[model samples]
Target: MDFSLLKEAMESNSFEKIADICDQLMLQVSAQGIKFEEDWPYTIHLLGHLYVNDVNSARFLWKTIPSVVKEKQPEVVAVWKIGQQLWMRNYSGVHEAIRGFDWSPQTQGLITAFSELYTNKMFHLLLSAYSTITVGDTALFLGMSEENATNYALQRGWTIDSVSGMLTVKKQPIVTEQKLDPSKLQRLTEYVFHLEH
Candidate 1:
């Protein structure tokens, strides 16, 4: 497999394309009858799927991985721990799995990006889904230390009750960015008028 594209994508931190690039590379390697066990970067391929939040794809990839590889490659097994945690919606487990592994340089960037994305996603979900949440739960969801999570919430304007250690989530107003252009609106209005007539 010519890994130039994959290397370039990683170097540039183009995480969104990693999954597709790895998928194409997997196909090419399979077509050439290349042995995956000897030199394949299975760690990167699996991490790419997780980076893109494609848990189902990650699960499928895990299932297709050869049993020997699964048994022999500790890194691949570690990556699947994150996938399994994600599949089960165990937020704390996901954080623990990510932090517990010392990932190689080749896969570290994707893992970091995945962690940040997961944190941001959980932050937004909390903002929308709950009015109040405990400090420990917030820390687990945000994948940070309790103090750091409390600080993060404070920075985002959420109030923390000191005694209860529960955060009062301050939901940000949703700002719609799609302003109606007058000409387009006029054109749409005219079209509707014609349709009605």
Candidate 2:
């Protein structure tokens, strides 16, 4: 199977679309009766899924990979470690897995993007979930060093209780406004009237 499409996508840093591209290519590989372990970059394909925050897909991909490939390709195993951490919601382990591996150029971009996405997501979640969190816990959740995480929180307008080593979260107020579409409501009313008859 020619991997030009996959290689081109990676070279262009199209991380958002790589997961879909990998799925398409896998379908072609299956139709052509090509061996998945032959020359395919399973590592990148797996990481692409994670980049899109599709941990379920990434887990399924890990299960489908051949044992030989899993054992021989340490990088593939390392990527799966990140997936496992994500699956278990072990935020600190996710950071450890990411930092422990030396990803190749083909996968580094995707990994970096995933890291940023995960960090931003956790940051928002923590904001809503906590009024105050310890700097150490924040570091684990944000995948940064304690000092860096403290600075990051501070820069985001969060205050720190120096005596307690706790960083206070600055949550933005949520404003929700619901506006119903008249045409849709009219159609629903008509449908109800028709059903009544």
Candidate 3:
């Protein structure tokens, strides 16, 4: 959506806001009834991308996986298995990149900027799943107000009308929320969002 706003959020190290935005977006997708499998390659790619801010690398991993697997079909199962192995291999590269990056105090700003980009790009992929997401949901996903989400969407060249159209094609909901301990959230936020900052 609003790359500028996202940039600002990251640069400011606003983890709570970012988490809120992500949650809102997830809620919107859930509301649309488009399900995402827990072990889906897309989910893995999303996490990897967020962790490393590398879309091309994430894409490479995602493309390696096969579309289907059959329990009774040995050949099909093998292909899918190989795909997963390759995907995991490539995913390790993202981890390596993060480790290799020169993240010093001065470069903290840059890390935050890229982190925001990674988060926003992930959100874009999620939005693409449903035709039209609600303004409220979108705002919540971005951790902004409805007006902000709409403005951000417009700036990104997405139209409300198109989002509405996508919502019409109902799919089974795959995403769900489990109650996470506050300590875990704090730890994640500290390590993932605030570490470099």
Candidate 4:
């Protein structure tokens, strides 16, 4: 298979750039021709949307994943499941998805990267979900020590109730550029943020 575009897409760290490259290649090869079935690399396309946290695109691609790909590269399915859990805001489910999976050496780096990405996402999620959260819970979710959690929270302008170990969001307007409904805890839904695609 011709993997030049896929390799170039993989070289970039930015998801948007990967998406643009994947989009251009997909458009070029998806026309009604023999090239569509053979030349299109679904893995790069899947990774591009997934890296950007676009679950709608991921869900659409999920059904189209070739069975052989799933069977041969089971880690692909595992990472996608983790992404789905992150999308749904189920931190525990992410752990469950990762537990007991024997990843080959080739896929270990991917798992590590996904773990790092998950921790970053969890911090933002916890901040969005609560005005105050227990340091213990934050540590648990982030897989970090309570000391680190407390320090990180403090660094982010959170007030620490040392006696209760509670990290409270400092009294200030939560300025969010995204039209997020603070009331919704699980899924991101508001204005144009809704998953229409």
Candidate 5:
């Protein structure tokens, strides 16, 4: 897999495509019985590192699993906000990786191919309930705060930010640029200038 292309897709906020690629890779891994160790660590130290990568979103899983399993296991929930802090740190890595890439037709094609694979993998995982709930279901369970859940999804590159502060409801081609109204920009600039003066 061309990591550069994946990086570009991520930086450009091409979430539909990103989700698709992730799904496919996950499916392939499952077919081969390859677990996402980064997302599922057996040890506390490994789990902490995986959380640092933004590869594992469910901190609660690591905390609760040992107790729920009724087995004596290592507890690693020393830090209260470890997961959030690591996610913020990983966000920077993601930004740096895809800082400036041309969103060309070829790049789009590559994104789509990977996206399809990713989508498959995600579906398979969802079906299996591998660790946590499906993203959609999780969002629903979190309640009606669209912004919060949407931001969570964005971190995973699972949904694209679209017009009217809305996410595209279905998977589509990656949008490289978002169109903003010139009038709105001018007004906002004037407002800021006036405030400064």
Candidate 6:
């Protein structure tokens, strides 16, 4: 199947459409055989799983990634690494993997989306671990400026102790998403190509 469909679906920014397409591609991969050849469809499907914070589904896809694919697209492996770190609540590791991510020039857009998704998820994971953290510390851990961190904390209703610079994590849920334009689909495809051997 042509990636044009996945491209269009991803550009839609609707997780439902992306996931539906991913499921369709997964079925195709099963029928067509996941093999020694390039399987961009399968890879894109895994990306959709990540986009939706579906780590379990993404892990299932990881089991199918050929070793050849692993060697070529370390980003695929990086995806796993990022997920593992998240699972372990190893924000530091997630931070290292995501920040040091040498994204292929072609994937800048798709990577941007993935980066945002992972970053947001990681921040919440950190909150789950710590009930109270210093504002500066939270900012550093979140990779945001102190001011931005304070603003985010305020927005999230996280308690702030101005005198102590402490930001307390309140049990509130929120998602902050700023989607990119759909025009980057081609670049996302080109990026997957770069990951190819």
TM-scores vs. true structure, each candidate: 0.88, 0.85, 0.29, 0.64, 0.21, 0.65
- Specify the poorest-scoring 10-residue window by lDDT in model 4: 32-41
Worst 10 residues of 5 by lDDT: 91-100
**Candidate 3 per-residue lDDT over residues 160-186, each given as its tens digit:** 665452222233358988997999988
Sort by lDDT, best first.
1, 2, 6, 4, 3, 5
* Model 3 lDDT at residue 133: 74
lDDT of 2 at 140: 87
Task: Point out the worst 10-residue segment of candidate 3 by lDDT.
Answer: 39-48
Ranking by TM-score: 1, 2, 6, 4, 3, 5
Return the lDDT, model 6, position 120.
Answer: 79
Better of 1 and 2 by TM-score: 1
- Tell me the tens digit of each residue's lDDT in model 1 across 1-197: 58899999999999889889989988888899987764777788888999888999989998988888988888999999999999999998999999999998878888999899999999999999999999998998998999999999999999999999999999898888988799999999999999999
Q: Compute the lDDT of residue 58 as modeled in candidate 5.
A: 40
**What digit string (tens of lDDT, one per residue) describes model 2 on residues 1-197?**
67777778888877878888888989988999977684678888888999888999989989889899988899999999999999999998998999999988767888888888889988998999999999999998998999999998999999999999999999897989999999999999999999999
User: Each candidate: what lDDT?
Assistant: 0.91, 0.89, 0.47, 0.67, 0.42, 0.70
Q: Where is model 5 more than 4 Å wrong at Cα?
A: 1-5, 39-197
Best by lDDT: 1
lDDT of 5 at 123: 41
What does the lDDT come to for candidate 1?
Answer: 0.91
lDDT (C-alpha) at residue 93 in model 6: 68
Model 1: residue 16 alpha-carbon error in angstroms: 1.4
In TM-score terms, which candidate is top? 1
lDDT of 5 by residue, 140-164 (tens): 4333245665665555545543544
Candidate 2 C-alpha error for residue 161, in Å: 1.3
lDDT assessment of candidate 2: 0.89
Clashing pairs in 2: none
Better TM-score candidate (2, 5): 2
Better candidate by lDDT, 4 or 6: 6
Indicate whether candidate 2 or candidate 6 has the larger TM-score: 2
